[model samples]
Target: MMLNDIAMIAIVGAMTGVTTVLFGFGGGFVVVPFVYQLFLRQPAIANNALHIAVATSSAVMIVNAGWATFQHQRRGNVTADILFPLTLFIGLGAVMGSLLAGQLNEGTIRLLFILYMLVTIVDCLVSRRFLKGCEARPLSMSTTTVGGVAMGAVAALLGVGGSVMTVPLLRRHGFSMKHCISHANPLSLPVALCATITYTFDGWGKIPDSGFIGYISLTTLVTLVVAGGIGITISQRYFPKIPDWWHARLYVLLLIAVLIAMLW
Candidate 1:
């Protein structure tokens, strides 16, 4: 890659890393759209640009999630009781979601992502009562399992780290924002791995390039992982000081930005 491309990748990686930790999501919300636009500029990959973008974003999350999880674990924020079961169900769902994504057209995927963002905004705005109740009583096992599956599926389909869904759900279930983020960080690992593997084989022969394996770009992955690691480490040190109310607002604002980026 040229110096300009390297520079762009580094910038995106830095942003992804910070957001991944900040929101406890895989950063796919940021990475996929940007990569999609970048791919669009290259006529060679335009035909499968969305697929490549999504898959590559998922692949990058493997590293992003690992780094974030390590940071959270170090802070004693992760709850193993919640993490393991959710990871299992989410991984299964991620496989299914990746397969489903392969069958859909680009326009449909984009539409789904837009709708997902809109629904998230509405949920955040109207679910305060439900959240309070959840805080009082944790969700049942069956409910958490079902929710994990659904979250994993949607996240894999959209190339996100499943945090967008997990964080809010956990918050509603009464998990502190820190706990929600901590749990959400590790869950991305299974989802990313399953989705990445599925996408790799699904697009094996379809995408032919030395730097690419199926739809993933190794150069981008490496760059993002390194920069993301730095971002996560820095953010974790300061995130605890941010007030809870501000976290909600920041999450909402981030979603809004993602919405605009999608529509743009």
Candidate 2:
């Protein structure tokens, strides 16, 4: 990579780190669209540009999630009772999804990603109602597996870091917001790690400028990891003190930015 590439990665990393800290979601929901636009402006990458973007985002998330999970665990949020079994299917599903991503068209993937983001926005707006009926029931092994599989598929397809769905699902199922975020952070690590590994295999021998294993650029990954780690640590410390209305507004702003990126 050139000096310009290093600069770009650092800039992207700082931005991504801030977003992950504030939102508890990986930056890919923002990063992939931005990367797509960047590629459009420069045209250095090939037609499969978004795939590389998605893969790279997932790769970064693995590191970010690991850091966040550790802190969350220390706060008594992560429970093996909830996390262990889910890993089984989430791992497999992410691999399958990454393998499939290679054969899909960029336009189709982009549109689907946009649509999903819109739905997520709507869900965020209506989250209080959606999260109202939390009941902490003991999850059967089957139900947990199904949920994990579904989450893994979506995470691989969009490189979304897994917290958006995981948080709400956990909340609706009776987990507190703090606990939900904690569990979700660790859960995301497995999904991101699996997807990154699978995407590496699928893109092997073809992906460009991606440094370490496959489609993720090493410089980009390291930069984001550092920024995201700091962001998550700080955010977790201060998040609970933020007011609810402000939090709502933040989510709205995120949705608007994501929508604009998708449309652009």
Q: In TM-score terms, which candidate is top?
A: 1
Best by lDDT: 1
Instruction: Give the C-alpha miss distance for residue 217 in model 2, angstroms.
Output: 2.1
For candidate 1, lDDT tens digit of each residue in 61-142?
Answer: 8888887788778878887778777788998889889999989988899889889989988898789842343543666888
What lDDT score is found at residue 16 in candidate 2?
67
Q: All predictions: root-mean-square deviation over Cα?
A: 1.9, 2.9
lDDT tens digits, residue span 1-264, model 2:
557766776666666665665556666776687666655454555576787778888888877777766766777767898887887777767776777777888888888788877887777667773334345766677668887788788878888867777766665567655566567667777778877887788777765544545666566677767766666666656656544345445645776787887787
Residue 193 accuracy (lDDT) in model 2? 82
